[model samples]
Target: MKAAVANTFDSILKIEDIAKPKIEPHQILVKIHACGVCHTDLHACHGDWPVKPTLPLIPGHEGVGEVVEVGSAVTHIKNGDRVGIPWLYSACGHCEYCLSGRESLCLSQENAGYSVNGGYAEYCAAHADYVVKVPEGLNYVDAAPLFCAGVTTYKALKVSEAKPGDWVAIFGIGGLGHLAVQYAIAMGLRVVAVDTGNAKRELAMSLGAEYYLDFKTDDIVADIISKTSGVHASVCTAVSKVGFRQSYDVVRRGGKCVLVGLPPEDMPLPIFNTVLNGVSVVGSIVGTRKDLEECLEFVARGKVKAIIEEKKLEDINEIFADMEKGEITGRIVVSI
Candidate 1:
């Protein structure tokens, strides 16, 4: 099988032939169709993540493909079933977190594309218990990003506890932020999109945002408060320190602020201000299989769609370069 292998940190990916993995008793082999290139993949490639991925690793978790072969013990999924592989692959089922239906926070968990070989290849293997069944109506390329971006944003909104007619602000209208806008609209919440450029502002409005604010050109904190009375909750999809601080200011007293992006380990928080505002700060990771399934249904029903740029597998290096410079919008899907 040919794959995009990251041989070193901050280096270009090398296309090379590697042995195709054999299916384990509890796993199934999928013929890779498409994989979404996420910011986390770039973090891994540049060694920005806490754990250093193994050198020559294949980095891609948002994958959609057909089941080509199944292990002897796998009965839930059979040959020809289409599935989506996400970041949360599997966890120790007996852990305290897993027992409480919070598998995303399991202490003993394995991440696809980070701790193991991922979907930047011709084929990949995934545990049957963690794979999500992609709906037949959703296209493979578009469905790939939903595994990560869609599920993450959906989970964040669900955890916010805000209802319809509430004002929900999304910080940074990029790949994840764009999806957040669509989900908020479908959920009947009034959304305010915040970013630094005119293009992103326009893109967010086209996707049904009630208001768009270019953070660079306007006072976002005042603008949001004046328009929505006060933000009920805010999701910070961009992990910059400034963005995190801005979220704290715009949300109303007692409002919830969810952090979905993985920023640097040393990132500091404004403890005094957050405490005075009576704000609740929450951290959200990739969601469970059920969440991914619900996200797929949303897309299949035409309630949400992942805007994407498709490229061949061989252009992996070029795509990484563009993503690093923040040159791409929405999500980038690689056809494997």
Candidate 2:
């Protein structure tokens, strides 16, 4: 099994011929077809979070593959089923969060590419119940990003509580943001796409965003207010402190501001106005299994799509550098 192994923090990922993973009684072995490159993969390589990923880790979560082998206990899934191994690897099913449909909050959860080995390889294993079944209509490359980037944005919009005919601002028109724009439009919300460059602005408009704003050229706060008297809700999908600020500041009174991006540094909040305006600031992590299913269904139904570029699995390190430099226009899917 050829896998991109992360041996040390702040080091380049090495492509090594490692032994293939063995499945447990409730697990399945997948022959990976495509794995999406997420910023979290870069963070895992660099050990950015407080908790470190297990050394010699395979860093990827958005993996779409064909099930080559199913464990003895696996009944619902079988050989030849195309499945996606997502971020939420497995959660303790008896936990309150899991029982209540919020399994992403489970304390005893194992995450792909973090606590366990994940997709940046030719073969990967996952708990049968945890992986999502990819719809037949979705392409392997397109389905790869939906496992993470697509579901993350879809869940964030759900958390925002933005309704049909409402205005929703998507801050940062990148991987997740681009998908967010499409999801918002499909849900019947008017979208205001926010970013710096002309290319991103144009991409947003082409993807059905009702308006576009370049933060470098225009006062985004004022421009948003002028168009809709502030959006009904906002989702911050960028990691910058300033981006978070803009996401929070542009929401209408009593509206929701959902934060999806994870930045190492914290952003300062304005207490007085936040209280006076009755704005709700919330953090939305990756989606649960059900959310992942719905997100994939949206793609299958042609309501949304991930604009992706396919790359070889060996270029994993270069993809990380591109992400760090903010050069990727959309999501990148690595074909293994």
Best by TM-score: 2
Q: Please, what is the whole-model Cα lDDT of each candidate in the order they appear?
A: 0.89, 0.93
Candidate 2 contains a number of clashing pairs equal to: 0
Question: Mind giving the per-residue lDDT tens digits that candidate 2 earns over 261-299?
Answer: 887679998999999999999999999998999888889
TM-scores, one per candidate: 0.97, 0.98
Candidate 1, residues 1-336: lDDT per residue as tens digits? 999999999988899999998989999999999999998998888988667888878999998899999999988999999998899878998988989889999988888898888999999999989999989888899899999999999989988888999999999888999999999999999999999877887899999998998877898888999998789999999878878877767889889999887656445667886789888889888798878888788899999998899999999989988987889999999998
List residue ranges in candidate 2 displaced over 4 A: none
Task: Give the lDDT of residue 59 in candidate 2.
Answer: 93
Candidate of highest lDDT: 2
lDDT agreement of model 2 with the native: 0.93
Give per-candidate clash totals: 0, 0
